[model samples]
Target: MMNHSMSAATNVMKTVIYIVCIFFAVLSIFPFWIMFMNATRGTFEIQQNSIAFFPSTHLISNFKILTGKSFNPLVGFMNSMLISSGATFCAVYFSSLTAFALVAYSWKMRQPFFTFIMAVLMIPAQVSGIGFYQFMYRIGWTNSLWPLILPAIASPAVVFFMRQYLLATLSLDVVNSARIDGSGEFATFNRIILPIMKPAMATQAIFSFVFSWNELFRPLILLTDNEKYTMPIMVSLLRGDIYKTEYGSVYLGLSLTVLPLFIIYFLLSKYIIEGVALGSIKE
Candidate 1:
């Protein structure tokens, strides 16, 4: 009788937890759904109705308005893709490499170096924006994507995450074995360490990519040429006069901007979930 009662209570608890999770999931997705719905509405309808759950038939019209004379979404999309892709690649690969070196190799300054990196992680990038922009301007890279892409190679946050992940998953014995087998350091990192770090890499890659794609302030300050503007910058420029703002067009651009992030998440979400689950289990 006692076991049966305990089992019943456990089931009830599980059901309640499931209900709460579903409720929060719906709440999270509701805003995105409304944004998408509003993309298919006219400026007047969007202003009048404000909140809508159902999609309208004005999607084509909204797209027309969005891509009309002044804006070229294709250029923005391509620029964002290039910058985000380069930044994500640099952040993931270099961070993992730095983490591997710190974890696998013994050196005198390793702890101090790691401590310095952590200190850097606490300092926001915006703190050095003036110096960074001045340096970029002096180098004549103000309108170039290199200024945006190159500094990501030293991402302290990614280094921290990669180091933590290596601490949990990487084994020194494997490194020793590879060295004993005459494997080069770079070869071992590329062939052995990287494959083991796939889940963590994917997780960080998604975050880095999304962050680079959505970043606006740096691009706004650096990019004077319209052709060099990223998606977020272009989207920001959609704001017209207060009385004549095109709400539908703005929402349409937003919806389009969100699409690539969705695709990236969909491609890597399984790895993200697996990485989180495995980390939890390990802990």
Candidate 2:
């Protein structure tokens, strides 16, 4: 009966793993439940009683208070949209361009150039924050959205990720064949390889969008004007005395800010994760 014992042991292990997974899932969902409950209760209602589980009824009122006339949450959302989209578009295009150039070229110093790019990728974003701020300020771009837009045109993370994927996926024979077929360099990239790089591009686009959308420190420092405030900025503005702090409104604002990211992840998360995993695994 050793075989029977072994099967029983395997079943026990499987059951244990499944139970552990369920526990973790519940743990992860607990915060989201709390946030939703908080969003659906008045700032004072929560203080009055200990109500747990699904929220009662206060989402619409909370949203109204959070999106007040003075704050104009919609304006903030629009600003974030413009900035994030601009940054994502620029970052993806240039990263792809850099990847293609590094892969297709055969210069004497190609290896060294690539090594430098890789080195840049290793540096943290904060390391360059001071320099970037100063550079923007000196150029009279500090108060405008252009500073945010300009910095994203050259993303080291995008370049490195794209380079790794291109080295794996892109074929030299395709480039040579394109050249032989009277396709110009620009035409070859624009027409041929770009479509194939969709997985990587989509991944980068989602990343850049999220990064820009959630960015607070840079925008806080650079964008001093209230008119150009992004979602993060607007979220930060929800602060006051202990009693005056609108926790319900804050929760509503948080949920509103999170909706776009949720949409993006919902749409592209599977392919993005697959692309990254495949690229890393093969490498």
Candidate 3:
């Protein structure tokens, strides 16, 4: 009788957990659904009951007005892609090298350097936001993609993330074995460590790419030339001249911007999940 009662309780708990999970999942996805629905209907129609839940036929017409050669969204998309991709590449490369140095090598200042890096990581990069803007303006890079790409190369979060992952997944014994086999630190990292870190690096790559791609504030203030605008900047400026808001085109723009991230997450979800799990668990 006791065993049967316990079994029933366990099953009840499992069902409750499942229900809670589904509730949160729906909560998370509700915004995306709303955004998509809002994109389909005219702004006025969004307030309507039935139309709010259904797809409207204005999507194609809205898309034309959005990409209508005059307000070229493609240009912004291209710029954002270049800047984000380039930044991700550099961030991964440099951060891996730094993490390897901090982990594999024993030096007097190693702990201090790590501490400093962590401190920098703790403070929001936006603390010096004003100074950075002034400096960029002084240089010719204010109206360029360099402003978007350069700051991320020295990302503190990347450094911290790689450091934590290296400590957790990478054993000193394996690294030393590679060294004993006459491998230089850089070569060991490139051939051995990099392969092992593929999952973590992939995770970081997605984050860096998405954050950079969706970034608006930095690009908005820095780049004045319409030709050099990033995706978010272009989309934000897509507000209607005649209408107060073009709900369809705005939703379309959002969909286009988010589509790449969705594809990337879908394809590499297993790797990203593994990487995050491994990195978060301390050995």
- In terms of lDDT, model 3 sits at 0.78
lDDT string for model 3 (96-185, tens) is 888888887899999999889877876765777788889888886788787777777687778778888788788889988987899987
Candidate 1, number of clashes: 0
Candidate 3, run of 10 with poorest lDDT: 43-52
For model 2, what is the error of residue 39's alpha carbon versus the real structure, in angstroms, after optimal superposition? 1.5
lDDT of 2 by residue, 162-195 (tens): 8887888998999999999999999999899899
Candidate 1 on 84-139: residue-level lDDT in tens?
99999999999999998789889999999998997887676688889988988998
Better of 1 and 2 by lDDT: 1
After aligning candidate 2 to the native by TM-score, how far in Å is the CA of 147 from where it should be?
1.6
Stretches > 4 Å off in candidate 3: 1-15, 41-54, 69-71, 168-193, 239-245, 275-283
Minimum summed lDDT over a 10-residue window in model 2 is located at: 236-245
TM-score of predicted structure 2: 0.89
Tell me the lDDT of model 2 at 238: 69
User: What TM-score would every model get versus the actual structure?
Assistant: 0.84, 0.89, 0.82
In TM-score terms, which candidate is top?
2
